[model samples]
Target: MATRSAPPSDNLLARIALRFTAFTERWLPDAFGFVLVGTVIVLLLGLATGQSPTALIDGWGKGVWSLVTFTLQMAMIIIGGYALATARPVARVIAWLATIPRTPRAAITFTAAASMITSYLNWAFSLIFAAILAKEIARLVRGVDYRALGAMAFLGLGTVWAQGLSGSAALQVASAESSPKAVQEVIKAGRGTGLIPLTETIFLWQGIVATLIVFVVAVVTAALIAPSGERAKTAADLGIELKPLISPLEAEPKGRPGDWLERSPVFSVLIFAIGAWYLVRHFVNATGSPLNALDLNTINLILLLLALILHWRPHRLVTAVREGAPAAAGVLLQFPLYGGIFGMIAFTGLSATIAGWLVDISNPVLYPALIAIYSCVLGVFVPSGGSKWVIEAPYVLDAANQLQVHQGWMVVVYDLGEASANLLQPFWMLPTLAVLGLKARDIMGYTFAMFLVCFPTVLIVVTLFARTLSFP
Candidate 1:
């Protein structure tokens, strides 16, 4: 060129900055903004409400401790499960699962059943397992779109719906915070000393019926809304010619039967033992001292240490840890920011204010439905089930007390809200997106429609069920 390009003018630079800011607002961690803004309001409230600075500091301290414990537990579940899933251990489990049946219909049914079963073990684990299994099934089916398969896998896993009904971490925490005595009575009634109500015959039956409705609704909606035309045609076009069977490379790794025990039997035993211990400990505590102290956190820490020791050196544990760390890094980084956001909310009394408003709006007859809506909204800010429980549980309990709402029903509402919102929030969908190599915008287009359809159905059914049972 004859002349060099002129430097950008100030107005042009300002315009560029404005556009960049707008772009960030659209794509960046908008979820984080919810928490941040809430925190600021909390701090201002604390200051305006004439609360002592010391009290604010103390509350912040408590919040930090809670965050640390919750994050650690979550990290263990995510990292341990991820490592196991990607390694030889989970391959064996899937191999056994595959042997049961590999048909498209069977894959759907088995995935749905296994999801419910494993969700109690760990929600994160269940989700990861289901995602991996779905991918495998899609590969086997050849012409099937992986995205469609992913959606099916998500629905079948039932992580969101089941978490609301019973035996979910969020529900358990809500139960404890709301009415320790009622939770105890539930345990005594043989509800198994978890978040789920003790009236298994009644509560579980209702839950099962409600779960079925959700299942059918989800499947139908997924089928109808699944992309059509070129995308759908491509998958359909390949359907007939595409092999119904998977190649050895695509299937779970299988080895000599005896050798299978050598590579991962220890981890298998550890997982089983830990689960057994958790259940046994819960049962013992229910019968004996309520102060039962079997620290699952400590157990998880010990298991991780053992994984490092046993799988170190010859097993290349370092590489596994390295690879695994990246997967968890996003969670680890975002969690602290989330904690700060929670801190600000607590400081400003925003959570209490919001919860109070929700309680005020709720009527005895329509309380469950209202609670569900509130939970869904709060879920946008606090996506982690455990963390959401910790921050919102106190306020929810207060609201329940004030509203004379049944704690179990309230827990149900909280579960539905938290779980349903997961499909929309970028944070929860990241893992699914990562697995599929899809963008957030693309994934949201599908999940958003799913959310709109499922959210109302869940609200209506859970509310009606709660009323019929005379749930408090």
Candidate 2:
């Protein structure tokens, strides 16, 4: 155990967090392990509640593939966001940013701020960019702790991404076609189109305030608890081979007819034009605020078109997306398993039983906080935000409806909890870990420290902000 690893930091939080890091380094299982284990636990729980094994098996089999369409949307969240972030211009901007932070503290704070900001735009983009930016910052800034940098780089996903534009739950609920079973119930309950627009979710004034508050808290917390002096571990001290973030397209040979077509701007421009026209027409046709037309499909299409134009060539964009495609591999693999879990709960009486447990414990005033805490705990073990929401939403939102809670607030609440747990769950840390050549244990200490701060901060914000939103 690294509890006695003679770490360099004297900061009380840093010391405390490393104890958790030491523990997790020894015992933490792979994210897939969590899913497999979760499947069993849920099955057992169902059986204990009087659900037959045959029925549970039937539900699992039927539900395993039920979310195929929704799965694709979630996959695109990573691919589209990756392509957009790695575009030459964006990459250039990130490189320029690295040149600005000279001191260790500034470097840490800047990385956190950048990660949170870009994550709020698209989490996949933020993850990649933060990794690249941290690498550059570490090269330039002396005495900066690499682990702290990695943790700061990861703050965006754990803090405010879910409250931002590419947030899965918010986007899912915003589209009637994409809204899951629970949201469909909401729709049936007379939410008009049964769609909660972005305007009422992430873009709401209350949500915006919550996001800003959380962002400031996270950045500040990162700066305060970051290790320094003899306690810090630099990339060099850790013996990591730092590599520059290069465009994946830089390696391809030129000259073949196919290669020429790939490199040519014509196809990219044509596709982008077609996509842009549709987006414009979509807003033009909107019956209410044009922004309400922004949904899961709209966001994905916009990301696709933006990436195409920014890359300026089919080959470059395709290569960029392909490089980032592996990042989505986890989602493709785990989502079906989650769908099965959802099936067991949603298709069975397990949902009401679960809802009853939640309702039994929380009144409307405390319900949001309870849901946020529960979501955070579940997120540590099952980090599939979109699919996890699908599994829990049927019961969670059902509980909210029972208490006459604002359905949209439930989405916001779920998002807050889900993001907070990302602080502890390293599932989404694959890209950052790869980019930094670091293991989950190295940076987890800092993230764990951040979680200690953020988890409570989120609960308070969710509870206090509950009044600012209500069911329409």
lDDT of 2 by residue, 301-366 (tens): 887888899989787888878887877776688778877876776577775675567679898899
Give model 1's TM-score versus the native structure: 0.65
For model 2, the stretches where C-alpha displacement exceeds 4 angstroms are 1-9, 70-80, 168-205, 236-239, 246-259, 286-301, 318-322, 378-408, 431-442, 467-472
Off by over 4 Å in 1: 1-66, 87-89, 93-117, 151-197, 200-204, 232-320, 390-404, 431-439
- lDDT tens digits, residues 63-124, model 1? 54446766666566556654555554555566556556354445544554555455544455
Task: Please list the C-alpha lDDT of all candidates, in the order they appear.
Answer: 0.53, 0.78
lDDT of 2 at 191: 59
Best by lDDT: 2
Q: Give the clashing residue pairs of candidate 2, or none.
A: 8-230, 8-231, 9-231
Listed per candidate, the RMSD to the true structure in angstroms reads 10.7, 3.9
Relative to the unseen true structure, what is the C-alpha lDDT of residue 411 in candidate 2, on a scale of 0 to 100? 85
